[model samples]
Target: MILQVDELGKMHSGKQEQVLFAHVSATIEEPTRICMIGASGQGKSTLLRIIGFMDREDQGQVLLQGKDRSKWVPREWRKQASYVAQQPVMLAGTIEDNLRVVSTLHQSVFDEKLAKRLMERAGLTEMAWSKPASDLSGGEKQRLALVRSMLLRPAILLLDEVTSSLDMHSKQLIEMMLMDWHEEEETTLIWVTHDMDQARQCSSRLWFLAEGTILEDVSTVDFFEEPRTQPGRKFLGIQSVRERKWSGEGINYV
Candidate 1:
């Protein structure tokens, strides 16, 4: 397994006691693309942070490459994976500087040519190399963020709504780049998204989350074909199918 999350749970310190999932378990294999779908504020971003090592889980273990992550240094684990957020967080520098920071982390000799190629692949070739990152448009910023992540060539990628703010063309470009990366490098992708259509198009598996727990975990086809949980069916707008009384191992629609 490329990544394993066992019995993951998180709770904030408050009287209301908001719990973000309990007993969440998942394993990602090489070249696997998983789309986590749910309503807004369902802790999808929180789950990504936990997996990415940006935030620690209140309980449970995250294993990368079959080694318990807690046993490893946090910086070492971060070197093995890259987390890209919805908004691009660019530093006060040029695009070249941004790419260099990540490339130098793993490579002894940073190759500017390779960096330029990757940026071009991400649709950032038009004067992006020399321009200030702060001056780029929203789509440009998103692509630049992806290019920065790609420079690290991480085995696992944690994406939190990376495409939520892009236009149709930019979104398609990102989709193509992700598919190419998955096929070429066997990278494992875990993305949190609200767009079911986009999720169906890009991911091989789906994990549906709601109220701090996973409602269903299944193949993307099964999710759309016969959602096993009422929350899953309702989220997918398959009320008619639920009324037909199809039985499955997961939760039943009421």
Candidate 2:
């Protein structure tokens, strides 16, 4: 398996402690698109953070490439399982500096040809590498952030609402670019998205979080066609289909 989570449990730490979620288990045997969706406070971002090694899971063991997370070096783990935050922060320098940081930190040669191709695919060809990275628009920053993460050549990409703040056009661009990137690199994508359409369009599998855990894990088509759980149906705005009974006098709604 590429990745595996065994009984992951998390807690909300503060003045009063509470269980955020528990009994969450999953395995990614190969490279494919997986979308995590749920209402607010479902710990979607936290789950991604935990998987990326940015946050610790209160209870459970995570195995990346069949080795426990605790066994791997922090930077080495992060190199394979990289995260792109919702808010893309620019380094204090030009655009070139931002992209080069990844290679610099990894002590690897910067691939200029790859960077140029990624920038073009992200529709950032007009951008100047010499210009200050801070001056770019919000959408531009988000796209650049993705490119920076891609430069790491991670096996699994953990995206935490990376395209949530962009315009429809920009969001579509990001979605398209991500799909193409996945195909090009055969990267396993664990993307968190609230937009149902985007999830349906971009992901091959759906990881539906609800009631403090992953309530549903199935193919995108099967989940949308008929969710097995009430929360999943409600999230999809689908009423209980099987509950409808045919009455002798008239059709029963329930």
In terms of lDDT, the best-performing candidate is: 2
Please give the lDDT score for candidate 1: 0.80
* Alpha carbon lDDT at 169, candidate 1: 78
Off by over 4 Å in 2: 243-254
- The Cα error of candidate 1 at residue 207, in Å, is 0.9
Q: lDDT tens digits, residues 78-139, model 2?
A: 98999899888899999999999999989999999999998987888999999999999888
Clashing pairs in 1: 21-212
lDDT against the true structure, each candidate: 0.80, 0.91
Q: Clashes in candidate 1: how many?
A: 1
True-structure RMSD, every candidate? 4.3, 2.4
Off by over 4 Å in 1: 13-15, 242-254
Which candidate number would show the highest TM-score if scored against the true structure?
A: 2
TM-score of 1: 0.90
